[model samples]
Target: MPRTTLAPTLALMLALASPAAATQEYILPTLFDVAGVAADDVLNIRADPNPTAPVIGTLAPDATRIEVVEERRGWVRVNTGEGSGWVNSRFLTYRTDVWNEGALPQGWQCFGTEPFWAFIPQGDSVVLGGPDTPNDMRKVQSVLSTGVFRDPTRAVVAEGMTLVSTPQLCSDGMSDRLFGLRAELVIQGNQPRMLSGCCSIQP
Candidate 1:
């Protein structure tokens, strides 16, 4: 390359490497891991994005695969027991392995009350069990989602069931744990029951 062209090319490369360009790739509805806390210490979740905010909950020092819903002023919003809280972003490390191309994350679980139903994804089929329905496995058909890479809306279609999860605050109604995604499951049968619940990427 000529000297005149080299300067502009080098400048363009540096510009793309800047922090501003990197921020575009960092989006919400992503996973995070607890970091910078001692083994005996716990990370506090506050009610607001300030140091003096009321403490809402705490996370174990070794907690991993935490879903962060939003970020504000160096604080990241995470779901705690039945609610959302903010934690200092400095203590959480982002995870690169995220749900992409409409694929569900590993160990994804969905459950609901008012009949007590649960959907568990196994190797190639989805195990659906409830108090009323028979415990049966359905073959996986396809997973679809929005075009945006970071969007947290996805649908899992099977032989007789379609499970759709969207980015929203959800509660199990019995537990104090808040959830980042709201799940709706439709079972195609004689009755065609529709169930609503919450989902979590964490265990």
Candidate 2:
């Protein structure tokens, strides 16, 4: 205290206040999407709300099913089937309308080429085959024809994984068909790691 300078004292105060200032809270949007990553780098899925936390798992580029749990200080808590962890908020995008309507469950990442025709189940993996007929049941048969059907013998779907399924249509063949075939695909390894969007029938 004998030689305390104003500059040094101010610096000390700033440092102590930095932690509190860095902590911020944001309301999470209903449906969020993660994109813009290469298909190689391990998307670090962390346990704590901070990036410095221990890595619990990694998300492949083609992994589309991630459920977000909570948001704290620019960090989002999400579930990746294997466990729960945090991801930086910068990589996320939110859709309130879709989420509020129960179209997308909480903690799950909703994605599709079309807005609302199809979505991947949360915490599951999907492989994207080529584009298919929009909302057409015949496309499901086509995907199966490509030999991407779910293999009961394979382990969990991983990066570079592809699957084909014709989900039952939820609506009558009338205004806005609600059902269509979808290919949930995963792309991992190498640069640009990412979980691609679901390629489905057009809406």
Candidates in order have lDDT scores of: 0.85, 0.43
Model number with the top lDDT: 1
Query: What stretches of model 1 exceed 4 Å from their correct place?
Result: 1-27, 38-40, 54-57, 60-62, 70-72, 79-84, 131-133
Please estimate how well model 2 matches the true structure, expressed as its whole-model Cα lDDT: 0.43
Q: Compared with the true structure, what per-residue lDDT tens digits does model 2 show for residues 1-203?
A: 64677779888889878955654232332235566667776577787878788988776655553444456798876655434577887776653333222122333322444423333332333323334534211111111222222111111233343343323222222233232222343334475323323222221
In candidate 1, which residue pairs get closer than 3 Å at backbone N, Cα or C atoms, i.e. clash? 81-176, 82-176
Query: Measured by TM-score, how close is model 2 to the native structure?
Result: 0.34
Query: Looking at model 1, which ten-residue stretch has the lowest summed lDDT?
Result: 21-30
